[model samples]
Target: MGAVATLVAGLGIATATSANAAAGCRVTYANGGQWPGGFTANVTVTNLGDRIDGWRLGWTFASGQAVSQAWNATVTASGTQVTAANVGHNAVLATNGSASFGFNGTWTGSNPAPAAFTLNGVACTGSVGQPSQSPSAPGPGPSASSSPSTPPTTPPPAGDAMAAVAAMQPGWNLGNSLDATGADETSWGNPRITEALLDGIKAQGFKSIRIPVTWGQHQAGAPDYTIDAAYLARVKEVVGWALDDGFYVMVNIHHDSWQWINTMPADRTNVLARYNATWTQLAAAFRDSPAKLVLESVNEPQFTGSSGDAQNATLLNELNTSFRTIVRNSGGGNVTRLLVLPTLHTSADQARLDELTATFTAMNDPNLIATVHYYGYWPFSVNIAGGYRFDATAQKDLTDMFDRISTTFVARGIPVIIGEYGLLGFDRHTGTIEQGEKLKFFELFGAQARANNITTMLWDNGQHFGRTSLQWSDPELIAQIRSSWTTRSGTAASDLVFSARSAAITSKTMTLNLNGTTFTGLRQGSTELVRGTDYTISGDQLTLSAALLTRLSGSRAYGVNATLHVHFSTGVPWRLNLITHDTPVLSAATGTTSAFTIPTTFRGDQLATMEATYADGSNAGPQNWTPFKEFDYTFAPDYTGNVITLKPEFFADVTDGSRVTLKFHFWSGAVVTYYVTKSGTTVTGTLA
Candidate 1:
């Protein structure tokens, strides 16, 4: 019964949906509004009928209709007739509802509401335009942009960090580092950080500030901690500035929950009581505060039992319960304080939050939004050594993670609030300009979140914060950083993924695939795949950039020991690792291990853990890894066209220094030599 619309553009707006249902099947459409000539959309179809075979959804537009682009889902049209499809993601819609998919497209003719469509020969009766018209007329829908080759084109598809960094120029958090001034103070140095940060926050287009503080400084020996009027006034002063600056402010018990985050017993009564007490007094402190203030409960609680490494469903329940309990105990409109709850494992991996995602359902709080921290992948995101490349794999991983979060929770009516997501403070990626990378990270993070109507915040601590710190401390390309947030995609054409080894070339050139179809990527000596024109292949060089196409592309650069994910095979199955390297080259040494005499060496770095190269975690994205030693690595010779592509950011000074020697351990009986060469952003090696 919902109205199906082609869609429009706006912020915090609800989406439109279009679809028709038949006697036995129900179909749903997303981003299906056939838009104007210079526009596009990403569409999704879901089946609502019983299990059968494959699917086919057909519709008839008025007339002179044209298609610009689409992805995640497929499309095929004949004359005035039309049909859309996906890569068999969720083909058979279960019982209750069924739906066909949609995508981004640019049309030339009229886009009046098209006639009803049929799903697998049956009519669809559900909604279309699942969400509002995307702000970026050519934005990537929920499905497309799965593997971005560049930054987004419009402003909306950018990540939350990008958006926030762009909108909020003078943002503030009541709680920062411990100050040397003692008496409950922490400092990351420089008075300018606050002003510059606030400026940056406001510039990011956000008008909000969250002040999180632990009252223990005033409380001392247990129970209702005596409120320190001086500290209290300081908090208010900062909050006042933010309000004056026109920014929304959020403040709560941050580290106060530190003791509570780790190892919460089965009976969490004490934690809940403490939560109530803290909010009771804290709320009273700012009860007169305006609607811009929000209250959040506890930080990341690992709940140390053998079962819940990052806090289990039980602990999350306690967190949610604490949310309501804080409101009930806090006197006035604490009920409308826009409370926040996090997913399991601290960060927003909705797959982990089995229940909390839908917690709003049980509670009738309309202003509530689920809060989370998406830090990409931990080991990779957090630099164990200092310099590491945030390569394409890592970038893709974060993108997919956000997509999962949206599908799992956001679309279900609950809004997502990303409180922390940025480069780690500790030893992190080195080649990247701390500030530039910081800006880019937020740029994509915010844009993508905005794409699905999700709101987000960036964690600005000592390591990543800088009015002038991050860039100066590191040798960075500062001018490259953009000061605003808008929709962004990866560098698709300039990504530079081509075989350059002598064996691969054979004096013969190759063609590249954009989404799937064939397209001319290189002409004569040109290599980059730019947006404005058509491309064709000619000579062997692939006509690309010496600076742009010389190697692999990613978020930012890093110094020596930059972290990277090394994927390879280990015989029986496959293996992978999160490693640190100061170079971009890969080397291999063929060996034998059919029957290990006494496999004493741990080939991968003992400091790292392993996982599949692919998110699937199956043999699909399998990789190899081990502790680092002189002869520590063993290669899987099976997967051919097998070359390890590393990001230049991971290397120390490959552009000027001598050609470094890269070592690898390969398994094959005797000696096997391979040829290596560099592409614009990629490095290729072939069995010679």
Candidate 2:
């Protein structure tokens, strides 16, 4: 909160005020182009603010002259010279791009650099003097060397590109006890299952998403434990439907500390007034959520009042001083919340307690964070709840105990995140890594937690199998939970394309980047110009992300094909309700492209299930069109290793000239390549 000064005409320009980028941000400034005293000044950073992870550009120099030395990043000075670090490399630089760092100081009288200058507090724009001498430049242009230029610049560490995209997300168990009994959509944490574990995790690309939630079997301690208003308004309507279906949810207190840690009362004002009335009723119920509503406070906490090693480091300095007095208590839930804290037995690794380990200092608040968990060597990790058989020396002793839980929290400076490691893939799903080595160990630990920025989740409950409370939508397990979810918006080392002219459906583009940056999508339905909201191509399949066009604007409060949901891929049933809507409004409801066809005397598979009737209602109910349950039986001219690939959902490249009758959802023994090409009654095929 430090910007509000502007004088301009004489060139006073200096601003940096971010109470969260006012709304959106990519903010920059720090003298890589010059900011302080010698004053050549030119710094700007904006885009999706209000959620910063790294920025600290302070001001003031009546002359204390400190910061004389700095490096690729970290630099500090006493009373009045600030530069706070981390913004390079891990640049999500708010939506698109632009980064800056400053240097070159020394002022004698009138101008030394402050009328207002901020970077993480948001406030920038000052110009009171400097730059009118350019009009007199007629003769010899080589005379402009002003004696001040340090161009090399590199100052990073302000939440290091959203702490490397919140370290590469994946933390499950939301609205807990397996999403209060998963019916589907993984009961909101998302998990309808079957896009083959989400195209084997979007074909091996995973990014982030960690569900976890129990909130004491649905809060509502009625009146005071104060958690149950229809179970905290259905946990803020499923954390605003998983941050509007783009993932990154977190919401913990898992067992609700049995009522937020043993029912208050251990001094400190009745546990800081019941943890500030449970985070002021859960941070005013998700203060305009967007960076994926993450509020985890009390998932593991059970070590009991200090003992031994400096009272186990004074019980983690009284749980980091009750997590910075419940996140700098301004009212509750947390005023600019971003707290995660977990150590002691919840062990996110404070080096297994030897003493002095404690952290929480607020005031310098950038929305504090700290959480760490991993089952690592739990019987070849992915034993999926005592389902047994890790064999191979227990998968190399849980991969060297997950490389010692990733070399013990990637050597502090915190940001390791692994909320729940598949907790046990039940022998990677029914043993022998389900014939695929625990699903290629969740696709090589989601590219080793997006290359060690680490953020994981996969405790799965879609029915840990027939009895732990039933939830396993099947279909190769929600296509491996939508293939490790990291839907490319930025950094996963880049690779989420689609713009080959963006293909049809109305020129549906796609680019959702992160290293080179781009990401800004925003389209949902209706049809006007019908352009695909920033992205969603169909062919090679892409989403580019507008968080699914803000969940397709709630799909259908009315029409647009009346969508309750219809995302064919993000992997498995992340969502899908679109009954129909390209155009057609007859009291709405009924679509997957309803055209109507049936004459081939139907060949098996229960005559292709046929039932759909529409509003008149049929296909039994819960939406129709069934068939898919593992019907991909190879050989349709079979031989991917030799130019024979046909996957139009299964089959369709026909030139049938009326003499090409075929049907098979399961026929195998490879070799079903067909290649006819007539015209008369519509016929085309090419599988040789």
Candidate 3:
């Protein structure tokens, strides 16, 4: 979904006239999506020079274009020149840091890029500051960003925080429900919270529930900023139900992190006032609640207009200290309630971990826990930049982050909770990640968290669980995740084994991943296959004899004829599909750029991945780093419709009038080549 297209000729942007004060910078302007007479553009300004407090980016439109709407920054235009200033939360740009903003605009004649850009009156050249020069100014002094001289009165040791968090193993997030930003709780398409939903989760073996609440939209104007009594009551009702259901419940300030809390540095006075008042009301409302309840200071706390990390850390510490004080001083169960604190962005980076470590040590309170979030490796998690597999690179990223948390907090006697964990691509659609790869990610993610003595809460956001049906969207994937919490599951290099129907059947071999487990045997339904005659295992290699494959492919059926279940020494069994297929054929057709559908005879095969390339062998589509464009982004195979649809966004990025070759990879190990050319608004496709 993320695209970086080439700049059109004679429409080049970001040419600086003079170097000015700072070393240099770079500006990237790309078309995210386009349509007739209107389009959306994304701009990224990288600060390659010294750090800047507040920045104003200026550029000139080559064509007669006008900005209609913008986000992440304020865009204003005067004739042909346009300027974008940083917003409250994105005002500071440290060296090597970049600020991204997008806008929708209207264009006539042609949509040419700007010819130049200026950042704070200085031209951008995308160069680093000289080695001899130090940062323009040193970070804030300790006095400006230091902890409180006196720590809050440590709450009486009520219970072990470690035990409390540990008991919250395998948690579920009540996401997109109370956290919805619309008028009411059900504004985000999720059904209203019912006892039946909680019962279903409890029945599914979940020990904890995290309810994220957004109070800003429900509260009245300043001063008291009283949350609608009815909304507060509704939140209380849900919490009470979960508590009664014997689930460890966590409630926190959710979207306010970006709404108001992110403006802390620029408007600390009002921000902290509202923050404290909200928690005060919360403490009073749940004052006498049971000990199973926990309070999180903030959700991924962020700061605005800060010089750098040091100032940001200081500001966060101030908020955490205040939250501890307010809740601890309030009466009843608040005296020793377990509290959760997060680093900047709730990230696992070393600097963020270190900052949180300092906060825990300074608090010196036994009933405190640390929290962070995990979304797996960026590329693979989002299915971009050729990260289509959960290979060693993606595996190591998970290991390294958990290892750092294990050492920084878990090993230091502090319990760390992965407040939210899942694939970022899932936010768009589950199909964004391949089915097997997604399963492996969760399986390993659960095992690693358990090994590190940490707790993880899955971020559902209405994507995983069905509130109306009370059933999981994918039952098998959920089963694998739940199984990983207790033991290891064996998997293979892939879940698919392709057998071409047109060729003679031969012995098929696949390398097993094993994953710290041993393969027991293979089974079809309730019948077991013979060892040497049917299949053989040498080391981690698994071979199915041609005779066994012949029987499975009876009459050389076109499609999956049988599913073989692979049993392991422990945990859930892996499933392997034996699919029989032949080379697919594509029909040449014509259509507009908006919906250019290519007719195809799949011949009992499933789509794997697609690649696009030009004559020069350069990547020819979006995410140009790899020839393989995203699965559902650039082109999608609609098996039911028997057509492969090329999205409009893909054509917007392709060079007009150029022949682009498309490689369609099928699950049956078949590669079908097709070509398409875009000229003006018409597109033509031909099979190779």
Candidate 4:
């Protein structure tokens, strides 16, 4: 039998009709920012059913529009029909609960909204709205009507800056294009800015926007580095759009590689002069604008490829101090305008945080926000292929990172902004990331960010969400992101009954012996798999209802592991008896003069016997297995489901780049023959 097993339940299997009856839901599609050729769109799904364990939404474009990238959902298209399946966190929804995702797409001549939508194969009740017009092309400059001299200003109230920072949650970034090469916003793929687009974002429930602008290209040469009036006006126009809609906006100098602010010692005078000149102009421009408009000193200031030194940290601190002094002296609302400062390369690493803490703590500004960018584990968050698993290790790493930030900064009255944090695309496909895994990543990331008083802003580089269509490329992804913000409040790991743990599934109807555990919240991955929709609990026995079993079986393949988490109202620690089913299959084996190779898909380190079986049915001596030498020998073997190299003298007859045939005997009474070949540093084996 495999890790998964089919068993006849003592109780009768539940019928699907009851599950299908509770499938009522509705969807709404809205346009976000867009360009002449491309656009962004967002879709929101509302559950009108009895609690749902999982959901899938479908729609078709009226025009010949092609989706380029997506987030928060697993999006796939066949002809004109588009399907968005719920990721892990947003899969479960109680009645009236909602989830959203966004995407970026391209349209040739016309972009029309899909007229209808269906949720979980059932037709949705609401009507889809028409696609709004894309923002017009950039003009020579903003018109007098669009650019007001005395804009309606309601400055953010003066108080503890950390309080203001705490109020800002779930931020969005206008990525790639606006901060693209030169001042031509459309130079990248994004469309012109529009009020309708800002309205769409506000409607989608984002409270903050980070506008990354490349100011160096738009400024004059030499001593003063005077910013062009037209470029400033254009930026001011966009900032006005956000401010008019009552959004907390942060604008910064992004991608000024030509200025070399990172190599500060040599270019200190020139960089500081330019920096001072730029902020002086911006501060004067929005001097009377609402306090909601924040000015970030610099974006990722660091020496190229170097993990910051003390000198670089000190230079950055000097630049930040200069920025504060310049802004305060510029007059008007500049005195109280919120300012964001970045550490070396905007890293959240311990060394950089320590330096930033030492520097920023000395500066006496209540309106200052320390900023950092978190890509975290590069293999999972930024990798383009495979390796995007949000498993136990990932959870721990992320939790620890956030906890460090909380202890080092937030606890000490320094508010932090995760200016940019998001998983990149896996290959070119938008839906390549497993929906459940991505959702779980967001759920934990959001929860940690919220708990730590750190605000998180998503980084969208035109690929994730379209600015032209003003609709999310992946509606489900946006929903998961939103759910993280909405559902994270008042929840902490200490409050949970089973904060982080995994249980195995061995039978069709398995019972979890909770050992007198009580929980107020229970979730499978990020989603709150409901009691009636997913399972039923009686006394200490938590039963996997047949409906859930059927759903799980259909959604996942055999041998894959699933996780469950619980929270308690009483804060009592809960005990659970875990059951594991590890039916080991023959993995791999190879040999060389200096080393032997054995690959496995198992977890943990366990010693076993290895023997050779001859063609004459004779067997060699059973050898006591040892840990692979190429791995970290200090710890127990880490079975990464990949090849492991061993240094053993027994296989010394085989040399590098050679082929050998051997029959391997396992301790489990299994015997198999394999043909192994080596090429340079690589070894491969196939069962014979």
Best candidate, TM-score-wise?
A: 3
The digit string of per-residue lDDT tens for model 1 on 357-439 reads: 55667765655666667776543454322122344566677788788767766666566666665555333333222232333
* Weakest 10 consecutive residues of candidate 4 by summed lDDT: 1-10
Model 1, CA-based lDDT: 0.40
Ranking by lDDT: 3, 4, 1, 2
For residues 1-688, write the lDDT of model 2, one tens digit per residue.
0011111112221222222233333333322222212222223444333333334444555544433222222234444545434333322244333343322222333444454554433444431122121122111222222211322112223345335435344444432333443333345453443323322221122334454555444444433557667766755665565444334556755554544454332443555455556766666666556544566666665534434445554545564565556545644334555556666555544364222123533324455555555554553453222222334464554455445545554444445465665634342233322222344345445545655555666654443322222223343333333333432112121111111111222222332212222322222221221326445545434443434433443433222222211222121111112211121111111111112112121111011111112223222112124212111111112222212222232223222232222222211111121222334433344332
What TM-score fits each model? 0.48, 0.24, 0.74, 0.56
**On a 0 to 100 scale, what is the lDDT of residue 659 in model 4?**
53
10 residues in a row with least lDDT, candidate 1: 566-575
TM-score of 1: 0.48
Off by over 4 Å in 2: 1-171, 174-231, 236-249, 252-281, 285-412, 418-434, 446-455, 459-673, 676-688
Preferred candidate (lDDT higher): 2 or 4: 4
Clash pairs of candidate 3? 25-126
- Higher lDDT: candidate 1 or 4? 4
User: Every model's Cα RMSD, please?
Assistant: 19.1, 24.5, 27.8, 16.0
> Model 4, residue 270: displacement in angstroms?
2.5
Model 4 agreement with the true structure over 1-688: per-residue lDDT tens digits: 0010111112111111122244566777876645444566777788776555555677778786866445556566666777665554445555676766666565667888889886655678753222222222111222112211332222225856886776566688888756877558887767877777776676566668899988877889888888888888988899999887657899998887335565557767787788888888877888898878889988888655334486787787888888889898988989888889887888878888898887777777777888988865654553221244565677787888898888888888888999998765432344433454566677668768866778988887766556656567765456446545633311222111111112433322323323223545555533567886676666544555555544454433323334444433321112212212233334656544355556654321122223333344343212212211111211112246444343333333235555545443322233345555656645566666
